[model samples]
Target: MTVEVLRYSAFPEDGAGGNPAGVVLGAASLSEPQMRAIAEAIGYSETAFLSPTSESDPARLRVRYFSPRAEVDFCGHATVASAVAIAERYGAGVLTLETNVGLVPVSTRHDGVELTATLTSPATWTRPAGDSAGEALDALRLAASDLDPAYPVHVAFAGNKHLVVGVRDRWTLDALDYDYGALERLMGREGWTTVHVFWAEDRHRFHARNAFPPGGVREDPATGAAAAAFGGYLRQLELVDVPSRIVVLQGRQMGAPSRLVVDLRPGSDTVEVTGTARRLTLTPYDDVDLP
Candidate 1:
């Protein structure tokens, strides 16, 4: 039988921008290898596969994320894309996803022809960059001079582990270059999902880029997970006051510019990342071979 796959661009102002993600709403029958094959075939940064936990509980979904190389614990942009896809069919509302890390709750709001989805990330925390910092910088071919003196490097976790580095200016951020194999090896050893490199335009606005070598991607046009984790980093270190909202401008250097809005609530460990997603197309399994 043919499986169904839907494509959507998340965190974009329109369909032309944002990170493209594949949403597989009917994924109950697919095996692990099959899902991986599908994701590889789709060739998106990440793909979200949904399987209803029970027919009686439509609100509960078992979701899995896969990159071209391997399975990921969670993917925020794909989750946003999947939520918007669900809203298109069932109308905008709330949905709970069972991920590898934990339960994730997503809410959707419709504004005319567009849909915006907000995901409340899991409890977040930060740790010192430690010995990994030197190796990470080496992998990226960056020196200490390029780093932002205001914010130190940190290993942050919202749903997955990420190495967050703050650059001094947009010039450094815009000229991102790295050895893919070296970064992949370093990330694999460190168990990191991505190296989130950012430059603060202001306290509340930032320019960002993510090197996701572990996911078999050179760069992520927009990364909601990293944005959420960065919000945690800001709040944990008291860099930003609580009850703050930050905007992340990403993918500009890559020409596929995208926007992400992150909300940090006082006394709440979970941050919210909100963005708009648009459906691109739908494909049938018959178009490709299954693993």
Candidate 2:
């Protein structure tokens, strides 16, 4: 059998920059290994597989996420890309996705030719990094002095786990070099999806880079899951004011500059991540043989 895999770029900056993802609209017939194979062949950080749900609502879907190496419980960028694709085909509306973590609600809107999607993450929480902070810093080849004093290290979870680390300056954030093997080992042990390193330009604006060794990618140009987790971290620590709109700029160092918007509302445990996705010209993967 053959499957149609669409390519899209999520969270683009001015319609030019973002992370590319593979979106499979009809994947109910594909087995797990076949889906993994498709994701590996696509070579993107993550791919989204959408299957019809038993629910009668057309907007409800059973969504699964996969990286080149393994399956992920949730993926923000892929979700954004998938939502936009669905909206373009079906029409703009709310999509309820049944994921491994839980139900994720995504709302899609269109501004003329441009389509945007917002995903409401699961309940978020944060915990201190504790002894693992040293190991993470060592893997990144940095000392305690490299971290910003204002933001303490923590493990944050929205739909996935991310290590939130804040650095003092843009220079330090830009100069990111880490031991791939060591970081991968630590992430495997800690069950962390990515290590989110960020530099705050101010309370509302920030710059970030994500080390995503577990996904078989050395780094991610844009990480919506980590952004959602980081937003939870900020809210838990009271780092930012309530009802604030935070902007995260990423991927410039990798030359794929991307932007993500995180909205935090007062008295809400769920974080909202908003971004735009554009279809890529890459040919659909309709020729790949699947068992």
For each candidate in turn, the TM-score is: 0.96, 0.98
Scored by TM-score, the top model is 2
Tell me the spans in candidate 2 whose CA falls farther than 4 Å from its real position.
282-286
RMSD of 2: 1.1
* Steric clash pairs (candidate 1): none
Write model 1 residue lDDT over 138-206, tens digit each, in one string. 989899999999999999999999999999988898888988999999899989999899999999999
Model 1 per-residue lDDT at 288: 45
Model 2 TM-score (2 dp): 0.98
Candidate 2 lDDT tens digits, 240-288: 9999999999999999999999999999999999999988975544456
